[model samples]
Target chain A: MPDSSMPAARASTLIVVPAYNEAATLGDVIRALRADWPWVVVIDDGSTDRTAAIGEAAGAEVVSHTVNRGQGAALQTGFRYGLDRGARQLVTFDADGQHSSADLERLLEPVVSGRVDVALGSRFLEVKSDIPVLRKMLLKSAVVFTRVTSGLRITDTHNGLRALSRAAVEQLDLRADRMAHASEILDQIASHRMRYIEVPVHVRYTRHSRAKGQNTLDAFRVLIDYLLARVFR
Target chain B: MNAFQILGISLSSCFAILVVLGVVRRRLRPLPGAAWAALWIAAAIAIAEPDLTVVVARALGIQRGADLIFYLAILGMFIGFFVMYVRMRHLDEGLTAVVRRLAIVEARHRIEETARGEHEASERSPTD
Candidate 1:
């Protein structure tokens, strides 16, 4: 497998991992990422545990949030840091170990090749993960909602893994500090006319990650936020 | 006048006077204070002369003046709650922005400080 150790591969690329109380798993995630990616930054979203220290120990640039500002805020902070340092390519990876580091190459391929401004990982693309029936239904509904609202025909709407170009990242005005930011991002994509593609990437839905995934009630909140955005926009 | 009519008029008059006093004392701004004062004054007038409301209700095709007041009160409450909810949501978004900016700034400062400290420690080593 071709690695990012080559000068061309590592040029101006950054991996941003947003972690919230994932000290038990963040170290492994960061270590695996830092092994291949030269710039890996972990935003510790006010974790009560030793997540920041563990990330630093794993050779990641640790950025700590004084208060828990949710995953969306952490990702925005990471994106700002990457952009401020003149990163040409930025990948948003999960710190919960659900996302595979190997898939990072596939996710970055389209963006790095200049085919798309944003490449989003879709778990349903190849049936690579063990997604429950209920989760599949929920995600499908979200896809339909995105299609209807944003007019963007994408299969997976809320996947956490994505690669974005600097222009696309700069055009993003992320206001949702919570899980709803996924849909919000899609809205911005549609409005800003940013080119985006859904890449076939694998996600390991382990017991730990599924336990930390969005609950059924949180799905209702996302729906409410969508409606509120429409009503208030 | 009947005993209930006299009691209703007296109570509404007292409430209206209290609200006017509040407006005069600068406890409530003029706009909202005037609204409260107008509501209470209207209530006092309607109670003092029930026939007046009946006349207005009849023009509006309402059966009773009290029923019309009840419906208006319910609508007013709904509007009041909706406005308050929107205001609260705006304030919440503003607060989140402020908190997020502070967190990002403080985190950047701390990260820079740690990097500087580590750099100083590495420079002090004599392992050339």
Candidate 2:
């Protein structure tokens, strides 16, 4: 936290918030993020409700997905938009409001310092929070599989809030259309030889967050999808 | 094997084989399974019962069983092909719907962001 109070490098920081039917919390999330950073891009991912409208009201540069393209597509849209605006340090925050706004700096640490190309916010790292036992097991399994396949040594592999430098962001092409993109991003991290570090952050797992997180069945679907991709893709 | 009977089954079987292979190549993707299975079963029946071919051809006022199977194989093959074609059409529509909806949202989103950006810039102006 060397320059915790100061603005991160001359490399403009852009926050990319990917949302899917998050009309309830998006307004609050954007407002919190905008308190410090002015360039906030909210990808309203085909929400059937007023998600985009809410984001616009909160002073965020809102983009919409007419049809639901899933979280991965939304994040890709945000990332591409950030690049268009000349963002040197790009950070991704979950739309569900699970990540703490105060910990944004922690996620930005490695990226701002030029030490690591990407810095990921890990809820399971130093700052621990109440995660359901079921979620813990499912996450552990996914990280293990990803570690062995992608060859990236890091804990909390699937944490949604991650920061990437301009070089890393430009090189990382996340092609997966759905939640599978998290794993796909890791694959890019390994493929491009970008330096990545995981910093511990406080995750607020409220009732809303728990409702949004993946269950055992969803994890199984992801595993099956990954196995199938290996064979087909 | 009677020449007439062999000819009918061979023609139908060719159609049936193509349907089955095409679906299998799709890797059990969708409704093609039912159509593939049906074509295979029909081909089997045509191959197993030569007399049935004769009966069908005679019913259709044809002179031979070979003619009957040839026509029957062709019919079964068409049914499989038609069914698969319709199924693929349905899938295409679904994809179109999803894409169309997304396009609309993206357009609206760009306009809204532009308006918002102008408003924010005006507020930060020195004159204000």
Index of the highest-TM-score prediction = 1
What DockQ would you assign to candidate 2? 0.20
What TM-score does each prediction get for chain A alone?
Answer: 0.94, 0.93
User: Candidate 2's error at B28, in angstroms?
Assistant: 22
Name the runs in model 2 displaced over 4 angstroms: A1-11, B1-128
Q: How far is candidate 1 from the true structure (C-alpha RMSD, Å)?
A: 4.0
| DockQ-based CAPRI category assigned to the predicted complex of candidate 2 | incorrect
Measured over all alpha carbons after superposition, the RMSD of each candidate to the real structure, in angstroms, is 4.0, 9.4
lDDT of 2 by residue, B28-80 (tens): 65476666667666666766686787787888899898877677779978988
Error of 1 at A152 (Å): 1.1
TM-score of each: 0.84, 0.69
Per-residue alpha-carbon lDDT of model 2 for A1-233, expressed as tens digits? 01235464522788889888889899999999878777777888778888889988998877676677677767777777777667888889998889877887777877888899999878777787788888888888877888799987777877988989988888976545667778888888888888988889877887888898888888877766555434433
**Residue A92 CA displacement from its true place in model 1, Å:** 1.7
TM-score, A chain, model 2? 0.93
lDDT of 1 by residue, A185-207 (tens): 88998999989899988888888
lDDT string, candidate 1, B5-114, tens digits: 78888888888888889989999888988888898889878877888887888789998888788888899999999999999778766766776677557656877788
Error of 2 at B25 (Å): 24
